[model samples]
Target: MQHTVIDGVDVYWAQGPAPMIATLTFGCGVRDESFRTLGVTHLIEHLAMSTLPRLHHEHNAMVDIEVTKFFATGKPAQLVDFIAAVCEALSDLPLSRIEKEAGVLTAEGSSGCHPTAGVLLARRYGIAGPGLAPWDGPGYDRIPAEAVTAHAARFFTRGNAVLTLTGPPPEGLRLPLPEGPRVVHDPVSPLSVDGPRWLAEDVPCVGMSLRGPSVSPVDAMGLQVLSHRLTEVARKEKGLSYGVDGDRASADSASTDRFVWVDAREGQEAEVASILWDTARELATFGPTAEELEHEVAGFREMIEDPRFVDGDLDEFARSVLLGEPYLSPAQWLEALAAVTPEQVAAALTESLRTALIVVPDGVRLELSDVDGKLVELGGCAAPEWQPQGKVFKPSLLARATSAAARGARLYLAPDGVALVDGGTRHFVRFADVVGVLARNGSRTVFGRSGCVVPVDSDLFKGIEPAIAAIDAQVDAGLVFPPSVFAGD
Candidate 1:
């Protein structure tokens, strides 16, 4: 790839087929926003794109887990104009348009990743970083203008962007972005997991996520091989599933996650989940055959050698460049994949399954096994074993008299924070670590940094007004917010 610096941004390009394509990538995404500011990255993308005038060329912009990308395909001059307009809009966004654009975003109803992948990420990392994927946060319309401005200033800058093209730089191409230093974000780490477990969620498909190497072709091959094997078994033999898809996600600088998702036919969700789990176990035990490895290598080669693949290749390079991570050229990556053997692939899968988690659709019970060859049951959100001690408050007399569920619930209010005890499960939200609080209908729903939610609703418990008062007095006023007028959330 060819490289140059234009208008304080790194530009990369190479000759390829068809109308030239220009992609401008910024090193910021959903992972950078706090829970209160969730959907802000996408909000920014919408704000920038909303300013563009209608044109005949095909152009679009998107925000992912790690970066926001704007791309257009047209004549060289058209691309120059498109890119310049996007940059100018970002540098000085039309703040008046936020409310209008926010409603548009709500209608669009988009997410950073696939639904299954988003669930697994939240399971793996709680509610911070990539874990924020499945959440709507305070909602798009709820995001404050100050938060939007701060995020754009910190992330959408010239030094924090990389430009790639399917051809050489277009004459007069300029990136008129705000002058700022590159933002270095800390790598995201997984929340502490007790062990390998299978769980059921309200997902459309059955999926599995395992911790693995982020930058290993061998690991990639292992996952591809798994996908191939599932296609053969789930789709062809049993006719239980229609598709099998997965994605690679970077968990940190060194390690990453490999996910495998499969959608089952009606009345066959359990069967598909069983097939997926057994296939993974079988592969982990025996590894791939020489024929399997060769087939994957051929597929990888075919994908990399195509001229149109230059876009994907440059995307890989841009991710590494913007994030300060290692980069492997197309040729170098091909060489590494070619050298991977069956034994190495097996070992990689074996290690990854040690941290594996399988999530199936509702009503799909799974009998799974771990890497250790023992039977395992399904798991869900685990709360602390012991109840937190504090000023105890029982259910309101009216609720207790009317509802059985209310009779069993209790609230423990303490000087530091509060905990909700519902039967055997306990949810503790500490004021010192609360990330966000939702205030609506004269109640406060507290969100803790540790992924716990404690609702201090007056109707639920008697004498909870003091508890609500304590929460209001303890939590930082900045972290609390009311529902947006555009929507109730």
Candidate 2:
């Protein structure tokens, strides 16, 4: 109900306390060109933040398939000026030719040659998705500047914005008047559905999902605590993921569903999958546990049991917001967390985690594929000379098309070429376009740009030692690693 126009967009600023929180929401239109330009909106987000020199410190940005969120924290006095700058930038949008070029370079610096970068490259080259989606589809070509300009004008309209502020609203923190033809649209919460899919390249890769019935909206307080409890349960369980957590009604809409995820080891795929399914079954079969039922009635008291609750800090407020118990008094958060029962916890989990998605890092391509499974015994691939910028080897796990020569031995191949090698203490290599014996030794571990361990040539051992060691270690680890577990014939 609280609303006003600011610089051609709608503004909804709320009053709270010491440190204010502002949420400025805007509708971003996807056209036949934008989607193809992966991270275009993300790029715009960075640019907008950079443009606002006032709040350069607390900058953060997030982009989902549909929405993009930007937030910055600062003193109340400077809030208006900070927000004003954002409004100005949005209102007087710029899409100059020089700016587009600069944006491309910046995007490249961040993406490098990673596969994800392919999206941006496609966008630059005018690739459109499936058809002419609101957002561009996938392609690998440069997009014309004129098309970029047209896309910007259609979206970024004043009628498509929701700006909210949570803090001590300044006397003059009113919405800025607009000088445009655009009108504000009524808020329409987005609909989210799950068609969860997962893919990981490892021996133990697997995926699982389940769904349960809805819970009482009144019991929202218990939902947050239940997530923490479930996280603890999964973390302690063997073969379970290191993290398993969920949120109840994270979005403002009534139709939205809660979700949780489990990241676990490969072999535990079936076990963990069954556990998740049974957990949901337990919910419908039995109501809340005694502790869970009690916690719900107490109204989430344990959450705010913090000693600093009396001081009224930002951290406390954030906790309250996350708990979905924001309307409750500080005492209520503390009260609810303590009183929740096992039954209530179970019920909440049943409601929210009924439909769960489980992702395991198992490399099994399919449950069934016995077409004489091909193995690219990588130890047999041809080795390349250590030239500058040298040669790049595909992991032994990859299906190589050629054979390799390692120590005068011809490695075997099963469709995938150089199968995974087991180099006990020694290392190994699966060099570029090469098969088994590609390089005799394992390359030195060099840190990639992302600080990940990537193999490189060493001064000694001619790289063969490392390759052999790598394959041996795989064998010793007892993992059903790659197809090339055995040496080439």
Candidate 3:
């Protein structure tokens, strides 16, 4: 593959067969939009591609957290025409059908399940920048068509885009991108949460996210090997989980985030969480065995040497360049992987555990503790205090339950808000932030705009129907989302 700069846009060219693949990428996605303008980039993507003429080739577009890409694979002439058409569309986006496209995006988001990484990011970082999508609904109706056009003009420029091809250059190849300065995005600012924090979800599996340095290949490899070892022990040896895997994402120019997740059957979440912690601790403390290291290294080498690896796709290169990281060749990557030692892997794991976040299924608590002595509970800023006027429901006080810790808590309902007093700690949820009041199995849960989950202890609380109805009346008519949205499903 050869790299060059054509008309201020980076181009990567490689020689291949007749039907070639070409991808055009931009350094803008969810990370580039503010919380209020969350889905603008995605809307632009849909609109830009909506104008393409039908062709006998495979063509599609994808918008990720940090990059937006459009790709096509077919004859050289077909690919050339597709790329030209896409560029023209982006240069001057059609906003006539924007509302229709936004409805499509909203419907898609409503139907799809949120990923664990997105939930974790939203919890660690507030609904701003990269953390916008998980916490808030798509900003389709809020963002006007003029803002979409402005966003495209700023990000879809020659200076911030790249074109990569896997065949000879096509005849009459032209990109209709405008000349402009490259746009630099601000790094994501994550909230400082204590380690080993757990967010309760209604899923049956446990998910863990560990963050590490972005530019360290050795550290990345270590986490990969550790994930493999944990999966082997949890799924193969104990039959506790169905599958386990690990993935990495670019957090910033200087840092990378890695996630290790395990899925278990119902009634197995606690055990799975325990085993995951144990494996992580053991790997960080003693390092990988010789046999394990050998196998992992071999696998790594094979993957790098695979013929299909080739020069990375346009999206990968765009991410690397935009994040201010170098793209290593396969030979260079193999050398780095081979040089990684067990001690290094162990140290990497140890460092990653310092700020790990553990998410568990509902009603299942893990006995696992962090490397530190205490585990900090994650929450948002305290709600402002206000007077309680409506009927007060003391379900826990009436039940006289003594088995649970929160059994002594009190729920005070008001015309404008709800308050829960547990011992000395008081939590207030204002009507404005109360998206919905979820009632299930005689219990009530309040979801706050800050992603706080306040559940009335069902074991001790009784007759929450009145409280649910009172809270539901305060919420806006169209603002009530399904319980699954808060379940991290």
Which candidate has the top score in lDDT? Answer: 1
Better of 2 and 3 by lDDT: 3
- Residue 286 deviation, candidate 2, in Å? 2.1
Tens digit per residue, CA lDDT, model 1, 1-489? 899999999999988887999999999988898999999999999999989999999999999888999999999999999999999999998889988988888888888888898888887887888888888777777888999999999999999999999999989999999999888879887777744777788888999998876688888888899999999999999888889999866755577778899998898888888888889878888889999988887887898888899999888889998877678888898889889888888888888877888888878777666646654643545333445698999988899999998888988887677888888668886688788998987788998766778888877877777888888899888888888666652
TM-score for each predicted model, relative to the true structure: 0.97, 0.49, 0.78
**Model 2 C-alpha lDDT per residue in residues 108-199, reported as the tens digit of each score:** 44321212222211211112221112122121123334444443454444444455555434556533423333322222222122222222
Off by over 4 Å in 2: 1-9, 29-34, 54-57, 96-151, 168-229, 237-239, 247-254, 265-270, 296-358, 362-489
Candidate lDDT (C-alpha), each: 0.85, 0.37, 0.70
Please provide, for model 3 over 273-318, each residue's C-alpha lDDT reduced to its tens digit, 9 standing for 90 to 100. 8888888888889887777777866887776565544435344666
Alpha-carbon shift of residue 377 in model 3 (angstroms): 3.9
Number of the top candidate by TM-score? 1
Model 1 off-target regions past 4 Å?
371-386, 486-489
